[model samples]
Target: MAAPLAKEQILDTAEEVLRRFGLEKASVVDVARALGVSHGTLYRHFPSKSALREAVGERWLKRVSIPLAEIVKESGSSMEKLQKWFQTLIHTKRSKAIEDPELFSMYNALAEESVEGITAHINELIQQLTEIIEEGIRKNEFKRSDAGQVAAGIFYGTARFHHPALAKEWTSPNIDEEFRLVWNLLLSGLKF
Candidate 1:
């Protein structure tokens, strides 16, 4: 007999199901069947389909956030750190969009439906940026008086690169050059 599925195993299988069938068609039953169990078994791990989708979205964002968090912790001039952080976000988003457009589409849909998880993830990202900006301010490298506001502006200003709605634009031939221009402009504004 198949062993009872662990929650992490269920989430992993759910991700594959979502990837294979897409979020709209994937369901708790599908996940259970993939795991050789019943929908009731899956429910014990995720109370509802929405909860499962939220977990999937949370997992996707974690994959992106971990590296960014590491970059945030590295000791470097704020200018260097900020540049790398922005570039990392752009690169990560663009890579996901290009490498797995289908999965990216599923995530975009899930992000819309799983508001709470995505919202918290975004808030955490903004807070991370705020910390980096605060570091810069303390070092007298940036002129921003409000790190939170500055971080939000930075996130929004670079929305073209990271925003899922604008994913298609990341394929532009001059995207790198365009990002470089935007990065330079942002740095110029932030410099003391």
Candidate 2:
């Protein structure tokens, strides 16, 4: 009898295969081969190729989300926390796009195809922002009728800075300066 393969091991190898061949060319067979397992073995873990791709996307997003979650939990003025959260998000997204472009592209392709995972991730991010906005309102630091709505607006308005598809524009020399301008606009509206 063979030992069971770890799901993380499969996902790690799958990510590598996806990075090497991309979403259009990669397959579960390639992942299984890379991991020294049969397609059947990998299927037991992932169910389907789309599922595997979604898992990879989810893993990458989770890495970005952890620090943002920490930022949300930290002791600080809501304004400070909001600024730091946006900065960290932009930094993380830009780092992923610039430092490991191939992997970033793979995730982007997978994300476009697999909306369920990415939608859930985006919602979680908005939820995090909503909590921060709510905190600000509670502390009398911000004036807004709806934290959820404001969070969604903030997330969408700042998409150019962090969205993978918009990464090309981020390479411009003045991206940071542009971000500050946007941040100030958002801050002014949030503050009483």
Candidate 3:
């Protein structure tokens, strides 16, 4: 009987296979070879290459989400949290699961999967920001009427303006500068 593959072991093998061969060429067979496992054994755990790919992506997202949640929780201000959230998005935008924006989009299109956990994560931020905006409206810190839309607009709109592609290979120096610049442009009118 073959011993079960550990989750980390499986992911490591999958990552090596993907990185070496590219996502298109990397197959369950490749991962099995990398892990010294039989196809049947690997299939017992992952069913197919796509399933493994999704599992790997899910694990990676969980890794990033934990820290982003921490940053949002620890940030002192809603606006500060928003900036931190943008930083987190930019970082996530450059992960292995999304090596190329076009490739990632194609994967999304094929899988019909929505990165909605991310949208949910941003929703949490929006709720937090809504409260802040509400407080600001009362105290004249911000304008009122549609804090939720405004929050969504700031988030998605900024995300649209600074598409992950624009970040270019993750270390693009434009990320922070772009965030601050966009925030400044939006904040003036947004402020009370």
Number of the top lDDT candidate: 2
Report lDDT (Cα) of residue 166, candidate 3.
44
Q: Write the per-residue lDDT of candidate 1 for residues 50-117, one digit (tens) a residue.
A: 89888878888888888889888999898888888888988888888999898888887877777777
Model 2 residue 152 lDDT? 97
Per-residue alpha-carbon lDDT of candidate 2 for residues 1-192, written as tens digits (9 for 90 to 100): 767898888888988887788778999999989988789988887888888888887888898898999999998799999989999999998998899887788777777776887888899999999999999999999996599999999999999999888999989999999998998998888999
What is the alpha-carbon lDDT of model 1 when measured against the actual structure? 0.86
Segments in model 3 whose C-alpha atoms lie over 4 Å from true places: 1-3, 91-142, 145-147, 160-162, 165-179
Off by over 4 Å in 2: none
The CA lDDT of each predicted structure is 0.86, 0.88, 0.64
lDDT of 1 at 13: 92
TM-score of 2: 0.94
Worst 10 residues of 3 by lDDT: 105-114
Positional deviation of residue 135's Cα in model 1 after best superposition, in angstroms: 0.7
